[model samples]
Target: MDFKGLWTTIKKNAIHLFKKARKAIKRYIRKLVKHTKAGDYSVLIYTIFALVALILIIVMFANIFSLGGKKKSTLDITTTEVATPADVTEDPQIAAQMALKQQAMDIYSRNKDFIFLVDENHPLAEGYSFEHHTLNCGLDIDKRIYNDFSEMLNACNMAGYEYNIINAYIDKATQTELYNSAVAHYVDQGLLEEEAQAQVGKSVDKPGCSEHETGLAIDLTDVEVLGEEDYKSTRGTDQWLMNNCHKYGFINRYPANKVSVTGVSDEQWQFRYVGREAAEFMAANNLSLEEFMELVQ
Candidate 1:
């Protein structure tokens, strides 16, 4: 749900809870007034009711917004959910579309350059500039990450499960093409253009802001082309790579339980090369790239 929709849901639930509590309060007040032995406890009964209502409201706000976390004042939520194959089967058209979208996310997850939050409160940076190098599959990656990236791929190949570059470098124009295509895919799913674009923006980055532009990343898969891989067959063995990818200076960029922090979905097949030191630390701690950056900064 979008921000407004979430608020509406919270408000709706809160009001429902409040009303239920109010009814209980009234029942208690009725009991108090009915009791012959009671003194002037009407004021006390009403005060208790007020405290209960206030506590419920406070708890509601805290649960939804995470009031007590040192790092989070408000929840870092996006309207989009990471679409899975199971999510689209009912609509074959959307299923087919989601299949393609999944490919894009894999690309984005692997080599798709993205913005990291500039501060504790930001999950997205307002701007970025990148210098990159040409890599396999016509992909461009940030020049600095090349040696570790190459070493990582080499090590993966040596391990018997060969990994190939699906996409590495994406220029502004090409990235825009991917983003526009994602927007259209959602529109085809029946979302209005405005909402479709907003939805797509979360799954795919806009031009100049993508991680592929940074060239420090890559999207690797067992197969070279989009449609060739047997995803089911490879599923059982993915962890070996996940566990070892860090040694070569790569980390599963969007890891499980970190969608809230990274503003992206988890992708098991995607890895981001962050030099060995940072990569090892992140993997050891199960930290998302964003979280790792936060701790270091």
Candidate 2:
């Protein structure tokens, strides 16, 4: 109902009634003045009493109408249509996005325990197996995380942040080769074998101890800045990935500030998929995988 209009009409009628009553009271007072002049003071007294009663009645009616109108206004305000989840779900695009988010959350919940941290101390288990899916770029990753990884790269591309996957899914033999090569590089610098191995261990993971062995880590870099000495310091694809990868279930596995906790030097290009829930929590709380695992465990 149009309560405002009804209230306006009531107000107008009250004003009109007040105006009419005022004119009648004026006429009665004038008549009482003439009666008093003719010595009929009793008539004047009664007229004065009637005028007071009439004013009281008008004031009582005005108060009742005003209170009723105010209550109706309050009711209208309280019952105003506010958007609820159901209302928001009415939009098809929003509903679809919400469904996708829920689906991702469900997947994360189911695989919450799959966030295995592979580092020097926590090496990949013997005969560790995972289904692999090869991307068009000829890099293989864990099949379970392919969708999230692809979506993340796709989002990066959409945002015009181009990147190249430098490495992913290195088998134990490949990890061994890389580790030996790093050690050799140090040895060629005139260091003893033992000293070279120790130095290499500081930078490179030894075989099964590498996160790449899990098929859940990827190294990303911008083609434009690939060989730059301080590529990580530049604002490029890697930086963008580091800032936003968590939204797609990835985290900067070796953040520069957390080197002490991770026992690895900062590698801004490296990201590890730990599922959305864990990834987001780690990102938000600025936690390394080691710290996050400790908290959850």
Candidate 3:
């Protein structure tokens, strides 16, 4: 190994690197001095302009924030001032339902006491009346109710159970007369005028309040067995009616156990025509007409 030659080569390389490093450091110092020279006002002016630009950018951002805050405040003010009285009333959905109920009430009032006895020879029914007896009394049921009641009657006839319609719509005069008769009976039982009227359903309903007066109710009697009062007893054919009336869009209006709710006696014979869906829902839910009215209206 030529140790002396190797040492000489290393020494020469170290000197060369030292020169190169010194030159690079001098060049960097010169550049830094050139930028830092103080006689040039342009650099000072540029620095001042840059500082001003920064301040302007900050001011612009602040203005944007202030504008956004004002916009938000204006929106809140408008909302607070523009809300209307109608907007604060009861729900529109509820109002619409109440309007429908009012319409139904008007319709019922206009048709009060108009009897629609069952036409045994209706063209639509092919000469078969739903009623079993010759009296053939019934209300002019709503179209939907008529369809379901007709279907139910057809089914009952097919099953050999006899259904009869004893009465239907009664005008205001008839309702008043019936109510008066009841009041008289109660008065005979020793109740005072007001007390008797209240006890017998004569006071709460004037002629118009009775569903019967609306031409949307009917009184039915089952005649499967002889000497059996169908309306008074809930057995046999009467029981069938009680169980199945809801399916046919009819409900025992003054049903047993609902005297307090109805302000009337239980009339197993009396039925009111509601739509099938409504009848079934009311019966199943144990809802009285007033309760149903609350839900729907």
Instruction: Please give the RMSD to the true structure for each candidate, in Å.
Output: 22.4, 14.1, 18.7
| lDDT of model 3, residue 49 | 93
Better of 2 and 3 by TM-score: 2
- For residues 1-297, what per-residue lDDT tens digits would candidate 3 score against the true structure? 999999999999999999999999788666555766945456556666988999999999998988877355766677866667655545788687666556545533443332122211111222222322212343444443566667777776776678777666566677678878888898999999998877865333554456554445776667643432434645555667777888877777767777776655645567777666566766777866655655543
Better of 1 and 2 by lDDT: 2
Measured by lDDT, the strongest candidate is: 2
lDDT of 2: 0.82
The estimated TM-scores of all candidates read 0.51, 0.61, 0.47
The number of residue pairs in model 3 that clash at the backbone is 2
Taken over the whole model, the C-alpha lDDT of each candidate is: 0.64, 0.82, 0.62
Which candidate, 1 or 2, would have the higher TM-score against the true structure? Answer: 2
Poorest 10 consecutive residues by lDDT, candidate 1: 115-124
